[model samples]
Target: MLNAVIIGCGGRGQIFAEYAKQYPNEMRVFAIAEKRDYLREKMKKEYDIDDKYIFSDYHDLFEKGKIGDVIFIATQDNQHIEPALMALSAGYKNLMVEKPIDRDLKKCILLSKKAKEYGAKLQICHSLRFAPFYRKMKELIDTGVIGEVKHINQTEGVGYFHQAHSYVRGDWANEDKSSPMILAKCCHDMDLLVYLTGSHTARVSSYGLGGFFSEKNAPEGSSARCIDCKISDKCPYNAVRIYEERPNTTGRGAVEKEGFSNLEDAMRKGRYGRCVFRCDNDVVDHQVSNIMFENGATANLTMTAFTKDCNRVTRVMGTYGEIVGSFNDFEIYVKPFLGNDKKYEVEKIESGHGGADTVVVADFLASARGEKEMCTPIDISIESHAMCEAAEISRRTGKSIEIADIMSDKEGALL
Candidate 1:
C-alpha cells in the first residue's frame, strides 16, 4: 500500500487522511504533522497512528527523512512553500499541495523549479479542474462540440453570508495576512480559464472595489461585535446567526469545531465575532479581470460578494457555438450557431469540493505510481497563478501587462 504523510492537519489536511481511511488497500495515513493538540490527537486516534509517526511540528517529521510514499501539504496560504520545499528536499517524489499554491508568485515558481530539479511529480489542489462540472465543460470544448473558443465569461458569486464569513471575519480577512482577494478566491476561475483555452495568457488587466464592508457601511445601530450588537437580530452578518443557528454553514474553523464551550463568549472574543464593517479586512468586495489568450481567445472574470448564490456562472463563446453553465446546479447548455441547443446534467459525485476532493486524491495516488497522468501539475498551474498575480498588479497599476514579459523576467515582480 502507498503511504501518505499529512502536514498542517487542518480541515484540508484531514481530508487527505480520510482518503486513506476509506481506501486502506490503496493508501494509509502513515504519518501526521501538526501543531494543534486536538487535531493531532483526533488523527492519531482515528488513523491508529503509531507514536513514532506522530509529530507536533512538521519540521520534526521532516527530520525523520521522508518516510511515506507521498506528502500532502495543506498549510495556510502563505505557509505552503516551506513545508513543500522541505518535503522535496527530504526525497519525497509525490506531492500534492492546496491552492493557490502560494501567495508569492516567486515562491510558486521556485517550488516548480525545485520539483523539476528533483524529478518529482507535483500537483496543486486546483480541485475545480477535477470537478465533474468543469471536467465536462473541458471535454465538450476539446471535443470540437463548442468549435474554437473565442471568448469566455465566468462569474463567481461569493455569496453574501459566505463572503462575510470568509473574507471579512476569518483567516482571509486581511490581504496583508492572507492573499489578495483575487488570488485567494478567484484563482480557481483564472486557472480554469487557462485550462479551457488550451493556451497561455497573452495579457491581463483587472479592477477592484472595496470599502463597503467597513465601518462607514455599518448600520447606525449595529454594535462592534455581533453577540452584543443591539441590532444583531436584523443584521445579516451577525455572528450569532451564522454561529449559533448555522454553525455548519461554512467549512471548518467554526467555533463548534474548535471546541468552544460558550458560543457567546467565543463570538465576543474570537475573530468571527467582529462586525463585518468594523473588522480589519482590506480585500475587495468586487473585482473584474480581463484576459487575452495567446490563441486570440479572451475571457472576462467577475467575482463579487453581493450575490445570493455561492457558485460560479459561466458562458464560453466559441467560433461556431457557445456553452453556458451554472455550477450550482451542475448544468451546462451547449448551443451551436446553426444547430439545436443541447443540455447536460452532470452526475454529481457525493464528496467535498463538488466531488473533486476524492477524485483528486485518487488521481494523485495513481499518478504517483506512474499509472495515470495528472491534470493539474505545478507547471500548468503556474500559468493560472501568473494570471492572478498579473491581474492583481494590473489592478494596482492600472496597466494591461504582457504575460510574456512577466514569464521571461524571472526575477521581476510582475507575478
Candidate 2:
C-alpha cells in the first residue's frame, strides 16, 4: 500500500484522508502535521496513525525525514508555498496541493521550479477537472460536438449563505489576509475555462466592487455580535441561527472542529459570530471578467455572492454547435447549427464538490503509484493563476491587462 502524509487536517485535508478509509489497499495516512491539537488528535484516531509520526508543525515533520511517498498540502490560501518547497527539498517524491498554488506569482513560480528541480510529481487539487460533469463536457468538446470554440460564458453563484460564511465572515473574508475573490474563489472557474478551451488566456479586463457587506450596509442598531444584536432573529446572516441552530449542516470547519454541541460556545467567542455587514471584509460580493484566449476564442466569467447556493453554470458556443449546462443538475445540452439537440445526464455520486473530491484523491493515489499521469500538473495550473492575477490587476487599474504582463518579472521581462 502507498503511504501518505497530510500537512493540514482541516476539511479538505480530512477529505483526502477519507480516501484511505475507502481504499485501504491503495493508500493510507502514515503521518500528519497539524497545529491544532484537536484536529491532529482527531486525524490520528481516525486513521490509526502512530504517535511518533504526528507533528504539531510541518517543519518538525519534515525534520523527521521522509515519512511517506506523497505529501498532501491542504493548508489555507497563503500557507501552501513554504510547506511545498520544504517537502520537495526533504525528498518527498509525490505531492497533492490545493489550488492557486500561491497567492503571490513569484512564489508560485519558485515552487514550480523547485518541484521540477527535484523531479517531484505534483498535482494541484483542481478537483473540478476530475468531476464527471466537467469531464463529460471535455469529452464532448474533444469530439467536435461543439466544432471550433468561439466564445464561452461561465457563472459561479456563490450562494448567499456560503458567501457570508466563506468570504464575508470566515477566514477568507479579507483580500489582504487571503487573496482576491478571483484568485481565492474563482480560480477554479478560470482554470475550467482554460481546460475546456485548451488555450492560454491572452488578456483580461475585469470589473468588481464590494457594494454589500460593508459597515455602511449594516442593519440599523445592529450589535457587533449576533447574540447581542436585537435583529438577530430576523437577520438572514444571523451568526447564531447559522452556527447554533443548524451547526451540523451550515458550519463548515466548525462542524468538524467545534462539533454541533459546542457551536454556540465557539460562535460566541469566534470570528464566525461577527455581523456580516459590520465585519472588516473587503472582498467583492460580485465581479465579472472578459478574457481573450490565444486561439482567438473569447470567454466571460461572472462571480456573485447574491445568488442561491448552487453549482456553476456554463455555456459554450462554437462554429457548429453550442453547449449549456449547470453543475447543480449534472446535465448538459448540446445543439448543433443544423440538426436536433442532444442532452446528456451524469450519474449522481454522493461526494463533495460534485463528486470531484473522491475522484481527485483516486487520481492522486494512482499517480503516486506511477500508474497514471497527474491530470492537473503544476505547469498547467499556473496558467489559470496568472489569469486570476491579471484579472485582479485589471479590476484595480480600470484597464485591461495582458496575461503576459502579470507573468513577467519586475523589469517587465517575460519569464
What is each predicted model's overall lDDT from 0 to 1?
0.88, 0.86
The residue-by-residue lDDT of candidate 1 on 358-403, one tens digit each, is 8999999999989999899998898887888899999999999888
Q: How well does candidate 1 score on lDDT at residue 325?
A: 92
Alpha-carbon runs more than 4 Å astray in model 1: 249-252, 256-262, 411-415
* Residue 44 lDDT, candidate 1, scale 0-100: 92
In candidate 2, what are the lDDT values of residues 185-264, reduced to their tens digit? 98889999999998999999999998699888888989888878998888888877766645545575644544433666
Q: Which ten residues in a row have the lowest lDDT in candidate 1?
A: 248-257
lDDT of 2: 0.86
